[model samples]
Target: MRSLFGDLRGKIVGKNIKIVFPEGIDERVVRAAARLKFEGLVEPIILGEPAAVRNLLSSFGFADPGITIINPEDYPEYEEMKQKFVELRKGKATLEDADRLLHDVNYFGVMLVQLGLADGMVSGAIHSTAETVRPALQIIKTKPGISRTSGVFLMSRENTHERYIFADCAINIDPSAKELAEIAVNTAETARIFEFDPKVAMLSFSTMGSASAPQVEKVQEATKLAKEMAPDLALDGEMQFDAAFDEITAKIKAPFSPVSGQANIFIFPDLQSGNIGYKIAQRLGMFDAIGPVLQGLNKPVNDLSRGCSADDVYKLAIITAAQAVQE
Candidate 1:
């Protein structure tokens, strides 16, 4: 198996991906943008106050020729686009609030993608995840095959070069059965993006008929619904983690399962489990987990935790750009 970074390199090694940065310019963002530009990875578009953007760069004593600057103030489509987003909200948001929001770096970044001004967006260094995604849902909305938007984490072992995907980690708190199925399907699609033939495992605390709970039933029901939704996909569920990955345990627990011991896409029951599970794997197993990756939107719009590092933004920018190609 290829490393995740290897896969990213293959897909984006020479691609001229466009990225929207709403903060105009920050040192970290500029550095990553410059690196990507030099590597022939992406064409970065920074949106904000041009003077402030240049001042920030000069203050750092760095000059980057790779960045293209756009002033949000002078953007002719600002008011028109803001109203379009507000109208998309359908009374959920006021025009005043929407206009005020466009000034936000993340908001402007996503709107650029919405209007086809850019290929994709990467933001969230100064905003919450909800603050980042809400604008995307209100403006870009879901795609044709998508019923909902969710998140996924792509985890990889550097030594073994093995990779796996987990979904619903950053969104959908306690998804219903149908929603869980949606998460599975969406995650499988993400797995496909990285060239994986997905074998989905809907994880739970139980294995087959060994245990029963409304929660476990929810996972089982989700598996059923996902099968209905994607009948041709190789997927199964309501299995414990062991059964999903351990050949011996899976044989005993899920004798008839096609995904037993071979599942690479793990769909969690809820956000809490998915979030904590990926973190534990990252810290203890030393796996590189890339995401809380946004999926199912009409365009490639992603959120960043305020705690994210510059490297996170760079890699996620690649993911967002990949999403743009898919769209």
Candidate 2:
């Protein structure tokens, strides 16, 4: 990820992106924010007490390079933000509800991004996936024409330029065929943002009807729907993993598909499969798995693994900023 992050920093240097880190009090976030500020990657907006944040940076032998730190209780525009939150939630939340929810760092940081004070956000080092994602869905919402959001991992290996995307890994527990189709289209767009010419393979247990089951039928129905949704997309599936990744198996199992043997974006049938697949590749194949990046949001907001390192926070912040520039 070191070289990849360097290239991304260079790519987005002049874009003037600002990324919010809501977990400012976490040790990991403190170190990552220091590196981002010192290196001038992007202006990082931190949420915490100003004095404590500055002290933490000082303890790390660094000075604040003017990173924005906002305390929810002390923000001058608290009333304005409260109204915005209430309006965004329509009748679902009252003014009082908005006021209390805004005090939660994740909600406050997401509001910063939604209001254009920050271009993007990266959180979840010390929060659950739902806590990081709920505000995004409720406030930022999905992009127009997208009914759902999904998570994807950009898988790459050391000393190898082969980069593949694995999707639906961190969201959509048991997506229907319609939701699966949306994940495919949204993930393909994310692949394009990262410079992958997407050839998507929607995976199932059966490859081209070599066997039959409800699970296979779900993938098959989704492949048809996705083709209609993005006709130009190089996508085909209801296939097995081997047919998606191995040229030899693709020839025998799904020979007619233009993307069967050459897929770079893989959409799993469910969260259980997608999550386990990416971990397997990361641990066994030694691939660098760089996401769980949220797709289909109106603005970018990514979640980190709970056990993430300072380096993970640093890289995800850059990736979130890159997504900002792409928009």
**C-alpha TM-scores of all predictions:** 0.91, 0.97
Checking candidate 2 for backbone clashes, the offending pairs are: none
Q: Each model's C-alpha lDDT?
A: 0.81, 0.90
Task: List candidate 2 stretches off by more than 4 Å.
Answer: none
Off by over 4 Å in 1: 1-3, 13-15, 55-62, 86-95
Instruction: Give lDDT tens digits, candidate 1, residues 1-327.
Output: 245655666676666778887755566676566667666778889776777776666665546564788887788777898887777678887888887887776777777787787888887777678888887887888878667799998888868887889888898999999989988988888887788999999999998767988999999899999999999999997899999998999888997999989999999999999999999998898887877789988888887766767787788887877777676
Q: Write the per-residue lDDT of candidate 2 for residues 1-327, one digit (tens) a residue.
A: 556667789877867688999988898998998888888888888899989989998898787478788887799999999999999998999999998899899999999999999999999999999999999999999988888889999898867777899999998999999899999998898887677788999999889888888888999999999999999999998888899989998999999988888999999999999999999999989998887899999999999999899988988888898899889
- The RMSD of every model to the true structure, in order and in angstroms, is 2.3, 1.3
lDDT of 1: 0.81
Q: Residue 101 of model 1: what lDDT?
A: 82
Number of the top candidate by lDDT? 2
For candidate 2, the 10 contiguous residues with the lowest summed lDDT are 1-10
